[model samples]
Target chain A: MSASLRKFIITRILLTIPMVLILITLVFIIMRILPGDPIRSQLGPRVTEAQADVLRERLGLNRPLIVQYGDFLVEMITFDFGNALTQGERPIKDELAEKLPATIELSIPAVIFMAVLGVWSGAYAAKNRKKPVDYIFRLLSIAVYSIPIFVMGLLFQILFSVRLPVFPLAGRMDTVMLVSFDSPTNFYVIDAIITGNWPALGSALAHLALPAFTLGLALTGVFVRLTRVNMIEMLQSDFITAGRARGIPERRLVYKHALRNTFIPILTLIGLQFAALMAGAVLTETTFSWPGIGRYLVERIELRDYTAVQSTIGVFAMFVAGISLIMDILYAFIDPRIRY
Target chain B: MNDTSPLVQIRDLSVTYKTRLGDTSAVDKVSFDIRHGEILGLVGESGCGKSTLGKALLRMIMPPGRISAGQILFNGEDILTFDDKRLRDYRGRQASMIFQDPMTSLNPVQTVEQHLVEAIQVHEAQTQTPDATGRIKTLLERLGIMQSRLASYPHQLSGGMRQRVMIGLGLVLNAGLIIADEATTSLDVIVEAKLVDQLREIRDEFGVSILAITHNIALVAEMADRVAVMYAGNLVELGEVSRIFDRPLHPYTQGLLASVPTTEINERKELYKMPGEPPNLARPPSGCRFHPRCPAAMSICSRHRPGLNEAAPGHWVHCWLYQDHPEKEEKTLKVAA
Candidate 1:
């Protein structure tokens, strides 16, 4: 890389450090401010006030709020997020390992689906602007976007799962297979394939289908609309007109030439959407009873498991921040015009 | 000079557009022929419809715009009659165009070689097998582009070089007639002159013809063999370059010539620029459209439109001064007034 590019990357990384800290601090503060006692939620109604106070002291929850926050920050820097409150014995990292992958598996397909279908439909709409195809796509996108994710999730489950037994609903996999593998990675699909458990892999995907489709449909609609609008505007740019005048094939003109230029802003939208999905997949996960982080957050929040909630929020926040950074770097690489 | 028919013979062509506002005439009864190995200059102001005329010849007019009436006869066949398949074959094969802006004309994601190769592959599919890499390098070199620059995008190249690349794409197709629509207008004056010179070299060396559309009179004076001046979508004057410049007779043509700023005015005045803007084509003035702006406007001009008649040897002008018998003699005397 040139000196300028190196300087740019360095600058971006440095800037992101404070942004990450600020995010973590905010998550910590917000979770603390909400009325919830991690000790009481852990001990349950059987515990006396004395037992609750002892548990609070043991967990360092009795310290002043600023001191507790400072300690939490120091621990987080070393990647030690202490222990889970409700379970008492389990590490927060272990809980995250179980829940994070499930959420990711569910969300990844939806994201990929949104990107491919959204970009394609958007490009088509742009190419056929003001025509019937453009109008139909526009209407479809708006219709899909107008529906809330939870409503769409419920609707898809009703129509596809309950009404018709065409798909298996809920759970990561069926109980029938004695499919246990050496955990090379935490992801079940990868582990299943590694252990030569085809049935297990098939079952996993089967269970994944409804949630992916529902979640994907909801987000893809918005993506398609956003991308289509952006691509349509870009199509009218002078460069596109010039390409047409040069006798470029219509397909190449729309896809390779026009769409690629539309990517910078579109990718940014996709990144922010992925961040939102990490937190916002609650409705989809709950509807499907999928064991994902989004559903886990809702369950913990309802029971008022403050430690689990804070740690989970912190982890999710970090994931989003990390993805956004990667996207920023990618943007700089793809279009040199977008230097920091 | 060797025996070969003219490359393009645009016959009594007219074009109209159905805009949201109303129907507007873009090209009206304009007729001209471009011969082989000669550069024909189409000159006029921005709204004079020179670019529209160029697009009409190519049959590339988009929707809301249509050829209301015209015959663009390329090699004795009217292009307007061609269906989609035949038109596709004709475009980029027999004739191609280089647009004004080089930046937007190119697709950003694609490499330079990919852009040129696609154009070549499309039109030259029937002939020799496409050696994509070889042809691209050869064409780029012919247009004076460096070999290293082949991998660079349009944004990477200078404006002048990008136009050259655009020109190179046209050349790769071996097109007979190249319509360069204000092709050099976006470049610096020096670069514009250089590119035009390079274009002249290409025409001379390759036996290709060019329809160079521009608003700059000096460019036409330097580069064109024959010049046609358009006013409000109508061909007001057509002649050899020397005849049109030395003895311009049409009032609009006269006004356009006088408008060119020259230091030789000797502090006489700022310049003899014609007063008034181009008339609105949607509701253009009656009779001659130039009458409102014509310094020598007469009552006859506003009542009856003049026809282009050969006022001098091989020169055509649509002005009342060149119309009729004894009145022509009387008008010539009155012209001095």
Candidate 2:
């Protein structure tokens, strides 16, 4: 495996840890939310010592094997793990607050950029099928799709960062820019725009362009190939011909009619690919050295801080779930053939 | 610019599909004319190229399929020579086509209103005018669709409603020629009958020429003013709908009528089922394409193709059974004897 991809699987593991933790939490919630609330009643203030010991001894007997997990979901929420990233007694929230936003600031545009460009080029390729432009696009999509993500990131870093010197080589921003940057919410770009800090926005965006594009470009070929295949199928459909017969322009028939018809399947793929990218960001983050949750979770694991680890995983679960839920809702909106 | 010359005259038109193996002649040298304000039913079995002939009139044949030879004259102008811009104006303005399978014909994502308005916008120059909206609502209502259904997508509508929506799209631009190509085959019998009435209503109200193409003889009988029967890309018989249906001259047409299961006790005797599958267009029979399946096949049927002979007033048949023909072959008479 490529070094960057090896780390990506590791990051995927990091994201998946949250999923496993969430499953455990779901069991806890199910136990807690049970019709009679048996566990809560068992640990009430007046319980006898014998009963307590019996309950403790069984380790949740009468429970399925799957339900015997620890419950520190509350502690994970409070988040008081100290000195994980820094020298002495610094709160883990402080580290997370800074790193998580950097990852997100880089990710949002990457996903949007890749999806738009991918669909546009894919539709273009389908339109020009068997032509020189179509062949070139098909070739480029395959080439781009097969190359590993980290390798492309490194190559781009060498070209854009080292040789060309147009962007920052590593980190979210320059030391000079970082010193003056104030981010309470920790989302640098959003914070910059809201504050009307044009220079800070420029600095953040300038630093962002390379890694975001590299991250986006890596996954773009997948969208292109998918959209092209579906668009070609849709273009031949009766409605497309119907549109043509109605004197609807060929351009509208393609981009508006045929493209929208392909969206139901493509939206599903987008939802899946988005979740995959969000959870599988370890390598891209490592190559660009953007301090995100993947690195933090690794450090917490090294220190054997179970509370920090579980909580971070819980948060990651929510982010991925939130994105997928939004996508599915968007699916209902895009395709009238189905309801939520 | 001849008003009396027929709204559209298709002369020697042929559409050939270029497959990897060879060219398949889908519509071969078929000549016909659709006059103003008439529902001309084109009936044939599957693969007879009736649909290809309909698409050919509008120059709507896609790639791999080309109009190899012929002229489609609309208002005495050759549509085959029209450029892209002219073709666009010609379509949906001069002519439009309603398709088979309404389930797959209307864009699922667009509402009925959007479908109608955009179809008009292609020629109307303005977008979303109250004038267009009012016309669409009125037309949909006239087609028996409720005003509320106008906002609904195709999937929300029944098969019959969707077909009506398709008709609305074709009519919104007021095209001179409307090709209903197997337009109601996917619907149920009741829905098909209802749509047939609506089609006749459309012709009566708009006075626009319609070329109704279908394989269902009963449907063509109900809806068309005149019927043209095709067999293996050949026009075998054509006349007034009653004349053609009552006394079909060609053997293929007779077989087609004879095969239809009727409910009348007297007409419920042994049905004539056609013996063979449709001939492969890439390698058709030497003389008559239908000769192998033709129950009344003769030596001349396998040796020399028959030309059309008018058997009765306004009734034509392409068959060797009819004597008076203009063929130059001298040996056909001896063989017939």
Candidate topping lDDT: 1
lDDT of candidates 1 onward, in order: 0.79, 0.79
Per-residue lDDT, model 1, residue A197, is 81
Q: What is candidate 1's lDDT per residue for A1-340, written digit by digit as tens?
A: 7787678767866777687788778777777777866776667778889989988887777889888788777767776777766655478777778888989888888888878888889888888888899889888888877788778877777887789976776778876662454455657788788888888888888888888887777777777777787887787787666556555667876787778888898889888988767755788889888888888888877656666777777777778877887788788667745655
For candidate 2, write residues A1-340 as lDDT tens digits. Answer: 4575456546655665566565647644544344532322346657786776675454333454344333254445455433332233256667767777877777788888888988999999999998999898888888877788789889999998899989988877677877987877788788888888888888878878887898788778888889999999999999999888877889999999999989877787777776667644666777878777766665555543433454566666657756665665676678887663
Tell me the spans in candidate 2 whose CA falls farther than 4 Å from its real position: A1-71, A77-89, A298-307, B1-3, B323-337
Could you give candidate 2's per-residue lDDT for residues B1-337 as a string of tens digits? 4557799888888999998769999988788788898899999988999999988888888889999998988988999999988988888988989898899989889998888888877787865667889888888777788999989999899999888888888887778889999899899999989999988999999888899999888888888999999988888888999898777778788888888878888854687677889998987787778789876677667878877778898788888777534543333221110
Worst ten in a row by lDDT for model 1 chain B:
B328-337
| Candidate with best TM-score | 1
DockQ of each: 0.51, 0.65
lDDT of 2 at A311: 53
